[model samples]
Target: MEPDAARDIAVTDRAFFHILQLAGFTGGTENLMKLGEMNWPDIRDLDKERLVAVYPIASFEQHGLHLPLLTDTIQLDAMVESMDGKIGDRIVCLPTQWLGYSFHHMRFGGSLTARSQTHIRMLVETVDGLIGAGFDKVLVINGHGGNSADLRVALQELKETHAETRVYGASWWGVAAPALDAIREAGPNGSGHAGETETSMMLTLRPDLVQTDRLHPDGGWPPSVYAGRVEHFRRIDEHSSRGNFGDPTVATADKGQRMLDATVNSLVEIVDDILGERL
Candidate 1:
């Protein structure tokens, strides 16, 4: 008989755990889980005391023609990778929430969105399930702008319902402001959708996904067209055919790497502060 297929292993292993301990994972390996690869037993045995779980929330929205629909997810995942070893024991990075409320991009092809109310309900349920699983502190790391308000509402409700567990929601852009300022080109303001900063990060994280040849055509969208109004699907498409907001021509992989590093570093600080504070 053919041998059974070997189970997929987690990117993090015993060596990774040891390194994490040296870096500052005073907590034992019980809290860490290769969730995607591990079974229920592995998760049940996790160390609750040292676990700070993170959920990366992103959207499958149109990021112009040059970037993939998974740009937000890609960026968030890269940020998580940047935190590897640094916060391994202190923080257990959960799988990315690949879909989000993106009604604004509904008119654009390939955009998937959940209504605000639906999204909030989903978030609450998801958090509740996590709490049920024994995580005391959960961080919702959001990557899309449209999901911000709903996420806040969901977090508030989750905290009220589960007083024992604390839930924090933060937008990646908001958290990485200082770093963005440092690496930004065309000023900090130009880092809007499919703009310099995001494009830069994508270039670094998934160079193969980026089509630099289409940068100029894709970067042609004007931000002024949708400055004051709610960016609904119809209005967005009216402004640009490609569904992008700012110039992506200036993006570079090197700049993206730096921005990603800065973003993760900021996340580490935030996690540290949260852990240090008395709840």
Candidate 2:
């Protein structure tokens, strides 16, 4: 073989190998981004200063008559997986924690929840474990609305306990709000629980789990002067008999796909910011 030809081939091979590594295929066999899939030694050897630890938290809860009980978790799993595909080796992603604070939806029978305190402890412990293992930066991605308050509490507890560590939490919708707002046709009532956004995302991620025939609009807050100004605890069954809020009948697979893609893009941006210390 000619020397120039061999040199060119070597350069091409090296570039391909770098691309593979960045895409999480380290040994041409495994995904290094997924912490659960990697062995301890691999994790221990990782560059802790640069790699961001990710925890995806969601819930097994009711999503009205149309969506499945695992709606939140499933959508979150897909979002994390997509984010992994984009930001591969930069993040050490944990498996999605499918149990969240869903006590409000317990009336529907399929919802499961950990008490708020217990859930907060669980989050703190999980993130603490990552910090113990040398990861100083952590990001918590939440999927279920009911888990939002608990996540905030958990974040506060984690920061107070691990003063030097950097921790962040955000719902997928919250992170991708700009993109969602661009496409949202529903008024305020169109996108709450089991609503257009969640249903569309579920349709895009797991169409089989969404019951199309059962699609319907369901939700309304109590009529009070303090309705929008107040934050109160209310059971799903209290106002919504169908265990949902928002309009599901208008959800479409195309909208779901767009929302998922936009969310993934937003997640990648945030992960990049975290790694760059810009957030």
Candidate 3:
């Protein structure tokens, strides 16, 4: 409430850092291994070949009427943040790439996307840069379902170009499928896009962004003649008029916490696999 109090806090912070410096502790050990927060030397001094470089990518697009446009990014960021807390010193995390391949959701406002090839190229170049930086192990984590195919293409291209580099990618849900299946209350039709799974995660991570009053079930299209035997592409509007898919009414913060835990635990295991050269 007063200038003296503010000065005291600042002085205490300065003294703490001063003590750290006197004890031969550089600032790096105290913080997470986030690439964006570190200086050039800090990155250059790392054991590049041994440390995993995590590049998280998500979409900035519509998440139905109830969820925020940044829902996918927010969910993915939460997973990454949790993972960082577990194994941050062993990996360097790049800032999450917010834009993704969301052309299917273009009909809805606030959705942004890049052409498939462009998105692939962007991903390729980013990983290539990490490889150039001497990081032998790289992991790309995808958040939005729309970006899944493009990510595979990008990873394939990267492998073809840099056969020796250890570059891998996985969607958060795909990696923890069994766990999600065990925890989800919704059926197959209710866990697709902007569905119970995502809603539950949002409720756990950012309840304020979720419009509880507007939550409803949508996009449970009846199975067509080629439902499971073949795959087809359709815009979100084609299946869901409200710009969402699946049921959100079944979502709860407790389910969300379980999902979050499972996802993060799987991610940590994946990082371990990378470190062990198992994948």
Residue 6 lDDT in candidate 1: 12
Clashes per model (N, Cα, C within 3 A): 2, 0, 0
lDDT tens per residue, model 3, 166-195: 899989999999999999888877888888
Q: Could you tell me which residue pairs clash in candidate 1?
A: 30-47, 200-256
Candidate 2: which pairs clash? none
lDDT of each: 0.71, 0.77, 0.80
lDDT by residue (89-187, candidate 2, tens digit) is 788777778778899888888787877766775666667667767788899998888889988887888878789999999888888988998876787
Query: Judged by lDDT relative to the true structure, which candidate is superior, 2 or 3?
Result: 3
- lDDT tens digits, residue span 7-51, model 1: 121213332322222211111223334454455567678886777
TM-score of 1: 0.80
For lDDT, the strongest prediction is: 3
Off by over 4 Å in 2: 1-32
Model 3 lDDT, residue 201, Cα:
93
